[model samples]
Target: MYYKEYGNTGMKVSAIGLGTMRYDEQDVKAGRFEKCAEIPLYALENGINYWDTAPFYCDDKSEIITGIALSQVKRSDVYVTSKTNFSTLGDHPSRDDFRRRLETSLDRLKTDYIDFYHMWCMLNLESWERHMEVLYSFFEEAEREGLIRNIVFSSHMQGDDIETVVETGKFKGMLIGYNALNHRFRQSGIEKAYENGMGVVVMNPLGGGMIPNHPEAFTYLTEGTDLTVPQAALRFVASHKEITVTLAGCTTKEHIDDAVKAVENLEEYSAQEIVKQFEGKGASLNNLCTGCGYCKGCPKEIEIPKYMDAYNQYIFTGKKKSILDRLDNHWDISKEKVLECIACRKCEEQCTQHLPIVERLKEIGEIS
Candidate 1:
């Protein structure tokens, strides 16, 4: 229920924004959006005003379901977000193509104007420049026409790359992946966005379901607190002053309630103090992979993300058997393939967290 000014937007967004990507598949496929739609309604009832969705989320029905919930509420009471994927637009994309996508999004959402319309999935500066080249003007035209209130982007690029994007001053806000496990990688980007008076919303605040799945691995965050590991994980991001909203992908009513309670009695914690806690008890926490899959395109064709996910299990249990089991049972990859790494450091170079990927691969080779 705690609200903070989203940068200098003059809008006080809820600390916990409802991320509408995780609706129940059965309900969604059965054309049962009314049931799944209740989740966001519950979130709104609990003081969440920010609802984020996209064209392709939840089998391309997330925006429709979110629109169902928005129908019952006054438009001004909620800040709605949706996105258009630049990659999906074919080569030689035109302004009309972008506008067509926007019109479709508006039709699906049953709303005339989106509070925040994003240039979705800016992977690097090159892609960002391409988006600017192809569709930035269309975004501006839409904004001037009152079809979108704010122009923003979502990225998973490194801190320096993100700073470069912010320096363009083209956006009012940004959504980036940040969590207890990988904050160091994206810290500079978050700070730079905030410094430039841009709202910074965190997308994968739960490490893409890794933290909640293995709560025991992050006990340090909950020490001396009444919060569960998930709440503590959420608070870890919400506690940062630079962050505007912590987007949680909620499915059930309980998920919405838990996200609400996590930020209801919000407490701001110093970045240094939170970092110190990690350094004291879990210095290696930052090395744990969130399975972002940025480390693909290995020249040797090694499944790097799968091995790193296995590494997470190893970190959690401190058991070599866990690593072997992870590779065999979950990833269905042989342990011997860990030796395929040529130490070329391609994956390392692309890693957002700057993890010692080669070193970890070597360790996995030795242990497994």
Candidate 2:
């Protein structure tokens, strides 16, 4: 396994890290711990030392399984990273909460100190400012107490908010969503984060499974490359000089093998070649919607990007029922709100990427 320096934290982590989201279900289905444990141990035996998990994953079962697997190895030989949601941190944050969570995680994982502690899925500017003090304080205490070695945060932020966080110079690492279909971060956000000594870890590297077999999505990467869609997608993100690791969520051993093989012989594609490959695929309104939600404060109260995301997911993967089911579960807006787009063309004018918003909304309303 090829290893990369994890920012300036003085730790080298595998380019292909083991993600634990699949372990909980797999463990339950296989009716044995060895079934779930095998994948992670196989990864470690193959020289993968970076393991990432979260308390929210499988209701905290992921960390438990990870801990069980790593206990077989000497603690100093591996790295474990986990995250806490800010909502759980609460107001009047105490070391007790931090310590309790750490102890619980350690006990579940059967390990001592975590190599990295991340604030997971931070979305907006307000959320950042709201939790910054408590976050910093908790990290400071944890580091001083020898509970965690590094501090990081993962963001789905776009535009200025991403820039704001990267410029803070507080984090040792930043995990963001990046793939062949999602290249919005390659602008100032990723470059600035690297410049500030922050390790860039990519999530949704296959565009959340949208790139693997979806011909429409595959077109973006197969324009001129000999690589398969998955390989191209993996290489596209891994090729970035700033990216330290691209996190792949693989369920089966075969999936893990494919990812490791891809990384083993990964080649850097030049910036011009990268741009040309995506350009030849032809841009759609779907491509234009970076899901940034810059135009979301619409007076009509339209959930602009959410609907677009659902539509893109449906069109890209042919998972229409699943997409609609998700939309029904999460979207509280009325049917009128869904159909009430007046085609004022105001949203298109305000779009940062100059997307034809009115046309896209019309199509979405028709679909619904």
Candidate 3:
């Protein structure tokens, strides 16, 4: 595996880090520790030095298994990363609560200190404002005392709040969603984060498994290369010069191998050029929605991706009535109800592509 400079941390992280959030449920529940253990070992054997996990994955069993696998290998050979939900202990959680969670992970992982400790699922600006002081104190003390090597946070949020956090000059990194489709919405912010000398880690590089399962939907990925759509997706994110790691969720050994090979085979420029081709002409929105769901939290709960799918069908199949019937019956979303949208523009803000949501809602039923 290849390594990249992880911002100003003076660490060289593997481009394809193992994201351990999607452990196999059957294996985890059945207590097949060996089965679940295979992935991390495979990753380590393949020179993946970064292993990322959280306390909640696999019903809080992931840390235990990951800790075991890491112990079997050279401890100093791999970087251990995990996340915590300090806010879950209520808005004004005591600093002890933060330490308790960290200690729990440490106990489970059998490690003295984590290489990266993240404030898990940081999705809101207001919540950060409420929790910042205690968190900052906890992180500062943790680092000074050598409890964690770096401080980072993960989020599905885009725009100014993320910018605020990155600008604090405190955090070492952030894990956020960035793929071909989602890049348009957050590229500027990501670039700015690079400019500020903060490490950027990517989550959901596959658009939550859309690109792999629906190759026909993204033929642009196949235009000039032998890459399957999913390989193209991995390449797209890892190719970004500022990104420190591309964290792909691998539930199977094959998944891990495929992710590694994708980055290995595709040059960074090839991925960048392929994504750019789709920007204006190559891949139209009507072709595929990618189903990443970054354009979520709509006030009306309109299920925006379903609408996009219907819209895509209409464009490809010329089946307007089919689109209408499914939206009206199967999804229970009708043109009339869609009109209820407050035009709040929240979805558009999260959307990297800048899809004209309000205008498209008006034309949901109109034929091309």
The C-alpha stretches of model 1 lying farther than 4 A from their native spots are: 276-278, 293-304, 316-321, 336-368
Better structure of 1 and 2 per TM-score = 1
Predicted model with the maximum TM-score: 1
Backbone Cα, N, C clashes tallied per candidate: 0, 1, 2
Model 1 is weakest, by summed lDDT over 10 consecutive residues, at 276-285
lDDT of each: 0.87, 0.71, 0.76
Query: Candidate 1 — which pairs collide?
Result: none
Residue 255 lDDT in model 3?
Answer: 87
- Whose lDDT is greatest here? 1
Model 1: number of backbone collisions: 0
Model 1 lDDT per residue over 21-65, tens place = 899999999999999889988899999999999987899999999
Q: Write the per-residue lDDT of candidate 3 for residues 1-368, one digit (tens) a residue.
A: 87887889888889998888888999999999778988999988887888998876888898998998887887789899988765445666788988898899898888999999887776577656656766778877988999999988887566566787888887888888787656766676677678788888888887666556557766675667677788777877888877779997888989888888877754554334545666664344323455556688998888787786566555545677767876767677766656677889898665534467766666774533
> Lowest summed-lDDT stretch of 10 residues in model 3?
281-290
Candidate 3 differs from the real structure by a C-alpha RMSD in angstroms, to one decimal, of 4.3
TM-score rank, highest first? 1, 3, 2
Local error of candidate 2 at residue 137 (angstroms) = 0.6
